[model samples]
Target: MAREECKALLDALNKTTACYHHLVLTVGGSADTQDLREELQKTRQKARELAVATGARLTVALRDRGLATEERAEFERLWVAFSGCLDLLEADMQRSLTLGAAFPLHAPRRPLVRTGVAGGSSAVAARALSARSLRHEAEGDFDVADLPELEREVLQVGKMIDDMEMKVNVPRWTVQARQAAGAELLLSGASAGASSVGGISVQERAGPCDPSKALAATVFSAVLLVAVALALCVAKLS
Candidate 1:
């Protein structure tokens, strides 16, 4: 039973690590030029799925006493790996947004002005101004109008990325805490088991003689024996 539980824990931890690696790769691939928007969406989806799977596996491992110390350490390591992957994802999103915002779209036309005649200069200036105004109006109505909406969408996505990052890290931290608790429980169980084994050895060495003295020794030894057995049982189960 203990061996089986240890195997399950190791398997779960392996899966968690693989999922975290996949997340890191996905986030890193976000920079690929082809179908960037789609890639980003896919990366986010994969990260979310991995985070959920890791949390579920950790919960299952926590419920079993047969989990091994090495398995617990692996689980903690996977949590750290997942947390690091989430940080990379967040950073990647921020970098992509910053790069996208750095380059503004160029204006459709260069500014133009005409001057030659004293009165004609004014007329040409007026005509030039009118042309500029017309160009601005057309571009303004067609393209510039969407800039604010585009910026807002990007900001919204950034916020979502940040929120998801936090969600992923929170579960990893929880798993780490559970791993620590499991370690403590295993150590305490081992200590109790050793103490019980010691008492049993002493009792066996001192052969029965007086009724009252033997009864007291037997009772004391029995308690220690139980403690040792319980500890061994826990260790085996874990």
Candidate 2:
């Protein structure tokens, strides 16, 4: 079971890393190209799918204890590879947004100024001013809108990976330390038949599952939902 899970995790990780690399390259080349909008949309969609799939596999691997030391080491290597790629992609995206590269910016339309009105001169000026103000406000909002939300989605995905890495590492190190201590105690002539160690009974050591697992799962689900919604919005905008 552990071997199978490890294989699945590696497969997902490989695909995700490949997708990330592709995204980084594509964005680098086409950030300012207006004609590549559809290609960028497709690339983003593929990347999102791979990211979500890889994250799910990673969560399962962390939950299962079937992975050996070497397998876990390989997993970490693959994770770091993709995580770095994600960071690069995010940085490129930020740069693109700042330069107004990826998304096209249209000039705000100038309000038409009416002249030679024979009546209500002050009232006409007030109404034109109000219209101009509203148009400016709407244009300002639209120009700055989508970039932040997209940036936030990237950050959220990074956070999810960081949290999962923490969850796996903490328990793994604790188990290794306990094993090392046990080995030392035996070498130093501690009783081989001791029923307990460090004031912890066998039953206590085998206690219930960690509560953080549920919380992490919930967080993962919410992030995935937000990602999907953001993808849809981007698709529509494109």
Candidate 3:
């Protein structure tokens, strides 16, 4: 039972790691590099937390078990592998941050023009060209025109963040499996050495059934029936 529980826990841990990895990969492929980097950093942080939690659970399980030295060593080796993955994730985040920060900000162009006095025909042509240039500059300066694209990108990033957060908070079935396994392990341990386990008394294990309470409940039910019968008899008599 203990082995089964351990296997369940390990399976859950693996599933969680896989889910997190998928999120990381999806974030990596995002077109919006800035948002992607931020989301990747968040994913890495979440992965680190998961690694720590899994490590703690594994340590607890190992300590409670009567495993051979070889088994213990193998568990430690697995932990090391998990830790290495976290380290790699952290390093990747650092590299991404650096690369993102190095992206140069380009300044928006300021429209410029110079026109000297010339012949009437030339001046008229130059004025017409100037008018067209001014119209183009006005169009370019309309920041509101870009708002829909910016809004769309923002919504996309927000959806990604929301999806990732939901995945983190939702309880995985592996967790449920691990819990069931752990409960079975504890119950089996209790059954093996019932007398030696001193914390919970046997009576407590028997739960809350009481014969006196059962008798009282039975008596009350009988009395209620008799009373209803008497009332019906009185109604018939009347």
Candidate 4:
């Protein structure tokens, strides 16, 4: 369907939304662009409205799809890809809107004038002065109010699903450590068995690898290994 609103929205989104990495490394901080920030916020809000309307049409288009299992899967995949794009657009726009509303753009400075409070004639001027003073104070409040908290993730560059993971080196030291742990386990078991048959004193025969102690140690080692594996997985995914 042809839509000017959709076109405008897409254009605004495409222009305003840079790769997270681009924003951080290239665009720098949002501090220096007062006029640009206001314009972007207005553009973002317009795009969001258009997206909500157009997205409804997209949902219907999805429901209308009719295909074989393989083709249907492909169509669904495309839909999902488009949905991800939309989500990124919306999230970035919303992030800017929230921050912009809290700390508005700066206004141009106004000229100041001095007034006297000397007589009856001055009383009229004093009333006008008081009204102007209140207006100036309100403007000052707008400028000096607390700033909002920034979202660090907005600065994080978006990555393709394929870009999330990469091969990592398994250090030789890691292999050696695993081997050492295995050897320690084997020695403990051997000592336990030898003590069982050595005819040593009761307390001495119990040995370093008492059944419970050995089990606990093994379990702890296994847990540590699992924790390490999990940490590796998380690092890769992140």
Candidates' lDDT values, in order?
0.52, 0.55, 0.50, 0.46
Q: Please provide, for model 2 over 1-238, each residue's C-alpha lDDT reduced to its tens digit, 9 standing for 90 to 100.
A: 5446645655654565465445445432424232233344455445556656665665566556877887666555545554555565555545545443333343346312222234667987676566645665565644345556556766765675577566655333333221455677686666544534644676677887788998999999999999999999999999
TM of each candidate vs. truth: 0.32, 0.41, 0.32, 0.31
Clashing pairs for model 1 are 65-237, 65-238, 66-237, 66-238, 67-238
User: For candidate 3, which ten residues in a row score worst on lDDT?
Assistant: 169-178
User: After TM-score superposition, what is the CA distance of residue 153 in candidate 4 from its true location, in Å?
Assistant: 19
Candidate 4, clashing residue pairs? 20-157, 21-157
- Per-residue lDDT of 1-238 in model 4, one digit per residue for the tens? 3233444544544444444313322111443233344345355445445445544433443455363555444334433433455567646644553544444444446312212344568667667567656665565633223222223223222232122112212222322221445788899999998987676667576656568888999999999999999999999999
Query: Cα deviation in Å at residue 12, candidate 3?
Result: 7.7
lDDT at residue 223 of model 2 (Cα atoms): 100
CA deviation > 4 Å runs, candidate 2 = 1-33, 101-104, 109-149, 170-238
Ranked candidates, highest lDDT first: 2, 1, 3, 4
Error of 4 at 213 (Å): 69
lDDT of 2: 0.55
* Model 4 alpha-carbon miss at residue 91, Å: 3.2
Please name the candidate that would achieve the greatest TM-score relative to the true structure: 2
Give the per-residue Cα lDDT of candidate 1 at 31.
38
- Per-residue lDDT of candidate 1, residues 127-232 (tens digit): 6566645765565432233335445544654565465455434355444443455788899999999999999999989866789987899899999999999999
Model 2 steric clash pairs: none
